[model samples]
Target: MTSLNLLLWIVLGIALQVGLFLGISFWQHWQSYSRLRQGLPEAAEALPAVDVPQKEAAGWSGFRRLKVARRVVEDSSGHICSFYLEAEDRQPLPSFKPGQFLTFRFDAPKADGSGSEQITRCYSLSDAPTPEHYRISIKRVPPAPGGIHPPGRSSNFFHDHIEVGTTLQVRAPSGHFYLEPGSSPIVLIAGGIGITPMLSMLNWCQAHQPGREVWFYYGVRNSRETAFAAHLGAIAAAHPNVHLRLCFSDPLAEDQAGKDFHHHGRVDVNLFRIELPLKPFHYYICGPTPMMETLVTALEDWGVPDSHIHFEAFGPASIKRRNAGAAIAGDAVAAPAGDITVTFAKSGKAAQWSPQSGSLLEFAESQGIAIDSGCRAGGCGTCQTTIRSGEVSYLQSPDCDPEPGSCLMCVCTPRTAVTLEA
Candidate 1:
C-alpha cells in the first residue's frame, strides 16, 4: 500500500527474472559441454549416422570370423554341408526368427589381377534355436565338382576355406516371414530347400507353442536329396500336433524312404485336398515359384481367403515385380504416369521417364545413371529410394524405409508425379 513497498516488490521481480535467465543459459551451456565431452560433436549429432545397423540387418557383429567345422556332410543331387559355426570371443549370439536368413560376407580370389574381399550372400538358417552355436545346412548348386559358383559364392567360400577358427562377419538375423500368433491350424508346404524356413518355424512352435496342429508337406526330387529327414521325424515324434509328409517325385529302387512316404508324387491340388482337412486354417508355402503357384491355386480352390495364405520365395529373387493384387486399397491416389522425373540426391543426377519407359530407376540406368542394386526382383531392399514430395507405386511392399523418405527404386513406378531422394 505504500510507495516504498511497491518499489521493493518491483526490484525483487527484476532480480528473479535476471536470475532465471542466467540459470537457463547456464543449463544449456552445461548440456553443450557435456555433449562435447561425450564425443558427440555438434556436426556429428546433426548428421544422420546411427550407432547401430538398421534393425532389419541386425546380427552382423556376432558372426565374427570364427572357424566353423563340418559337423555333417552328405551328397545327393547336391552336396549338403552342415557346418557348426563357432562364435568368436565366446560372446552370446543374437536370436533369430525361424524363417530369417544369415548373410555371410567373405573374400575370395578372382580371375582378375588381384583378390577382392567384397562378397556377400544370404542363406537360410537350417538349425533350430539352441543355446550353443548356430548350424546351417548348405547344398552346392549346379552339381559342379570344383566350380566357383557351385557351392555358391558364400557357401563355397565357407566350405572351401572357413574352418574351426575362421572368423566371419555374421550379421544379425532379419526377415519378415514370421509365424503369426493365431489359433488357426497350419499347413506348411515346402519344396526342396524351401523347407528350411518352415523347419525353423516348426521347431520354434514345437519348443514354445506345442499344441498347434501343423502338417508339414515336403517335396524333394528323391530320397537322397532330402535334407533333415531324420530331424523331421524326430520333431514329429516329439510333438503330437506335428505331422510329417514326404513326397519324392523321382524315386529309385534303392530309395526306401520313398516306399513308405506319405505321398508318392508331386504336391498338386488333389493331393492337398485329400491330405489336408482344408478347414479355416493358415497355409504357409515356400519353395520355388512353381511349387508356390500350385499351392496358391489349391488353397484358392479350397475356398481359402488370401489373408490366410502366407508365402515367401525360397530360391533366388523373382525377376518380376511383387504380386500387387488388383489394386492397393489404402490410398486411392493415382500417380501421374507419363514423363515422370526422378532425382538421386546423393549422386546429384536426374532422369526422366515417359509412359513408354518402365520405371524411374530403369529410365535412370538406361540414361546411364549408376544405382547400385542387387536382387532386382524387389526382394532385396538394396535399391531403396526416398520420396521427397510425390506419390509412386512400388513393385513390392518394402522391407525397410529405403531412405528416411524414399522407396525402393528397383520396384517403384510413378503413380503420381513423384520426386525421389535416393
Candidate 2:
C-alpha cells in the first residue's frame, strides 16, 4: 500500500477507538440515570440529593427541647458565636425555610435578683437545614460603656451561660421571610448579625439551585467583626455561579485587599448598579435598620418593584412598603386619617389612635394598658389580640398569623373605631 493508504488506516483506527469510548460512557450514564429514576439505592451516591419541600413545623406554638451539640466562636473579635443544636428526642427532623427563625425560650435571671423568669426571643437559623442539626449565629450585644443601657439579655445569656450539652427550649422554625428554590438569579445583601438568615438562604441556593446565579454582598466594619469569612470565600471559590463581594468599612492595616474582602464601604443599591447590569433579580436584604431602610428606598427609587425587594425586620416594624406614589404607611388598606377611637376591652380603657401613633400595642402601652408581647416585629404572635369590632391595617406583613378574628397588635394600626381584647 502507498504511504497515503497507511495514514488513512491509522486515522480510521483512532476514530473507531473514540467512538467506542463515547458509546461506553453514554451507556454508563444512561444506566445510572435509569437507576436513579427507579429509586434504586445503589444509584443514590451517583447524584445530588433531590430538593424536597420541607414539612411544616406544625404545632409551632409548642416548644421542643434541643441540646447544644457544639458551640464555636465565629469571628476573631470573640463577640460572635455559633451553636449547633440537635434534637433531644433524637427523632427525625424536617427541613426549614431558608430565612426562618427559631424562637428560643429561656429561664433567664431577673435583673432585680427576683429569680428567673421565662423569656422568649427569636434568632434566625444560620445554616442550611438538615435532618441532623440546626445552627444559629449570634453576636453578643455589649452594654453601654457607662451602663446607660443594659446588655441584651438573650444574646448575652446565650454567649456567657449556654454551652455544649445544655438543653434548651426552642420553638419550631417559622417565618414569612423565606426563599423557594428557583432557577432565577438572586441578590442577597446582609450586614452584621443579619448575615445569619442570609447565610441560610445562600447555602440553600447553592445546594438546591446550583446553576442559578447568586450575588452575595456582605458588609462589616472590619475583619475582626466579620464572621464566616473563610467559609464564604471557600464557597465563592468552588462555585462559579456564586459571586461574593465582601465590604469592610474599616479594615485593619494588615488586612490585604483582594484577599480579605472585595470592596470598601457599606452595601447599598449603588453597589448593585456599579457591578452588574440591571436585571429582574429578586433582592433579599437583612441588615441594620438604617441599611435596610436606605437600600429599600434606593432600590425603589431605582424603579425596582415592591414585590422584588424582600427584607425582614425585628423589634418595631420601621420599614414601610412604598408602592406607587402613595406614602401609605399601613399597608394596602388606607388607614383612616386623623384620630380614631381605640379601646382596650379587657382593661376597659378608651384611647385615641392618632395617625402619628405607632402600632396598637405601642398605643396601648402609651395608655398604661398592659399586654403580653414578644418579638415586636410580629413574628412571635405574642401580642395577637382579638378585634371586637372595626378594622385594622398592618404596617408590614407579620410572620405569624393570628386567629381569624384577631390581629397582631404589634404591627397593625387601627383603621377605624377599634376595640381590642388585649
- Tens digits of lDDT, candidate 1, 9-105: 9999999999999999998777755643442333222222212222343355334564464457643544677777766666666667667666566
Model 1 is weakest, by summed lDDT over 10 consecutive residues, at: 45-54
- Runs of candidate 2 with Cα error greater than 4 angstroms are 1-61, 324-332
Residue 6 of model 1 has an lDDT of: 98
- In model 1, which runs have C-alpha deviations exceeding 4 angstroms? 1-71, 74-78, 111-114, 143-151, 237-240, 256-260, 315-371, 374-381, 385-391, 416-422
RMSD of 2: 9.6
lDDT tens per residue, model 2, 201-220: 88887777776678999989
Could you report the Cα RMSD, in angstroms, for every candidate shown?
A: 21.2, 9.6
The model with the greatest lDDT is 2
Error of 2 at 154 (Å): 0.8
Report residue 390 deviation for candidate 1 (angstroms). Answer: 5.2
Candidate 2 accuracy as TM-score: 0.83
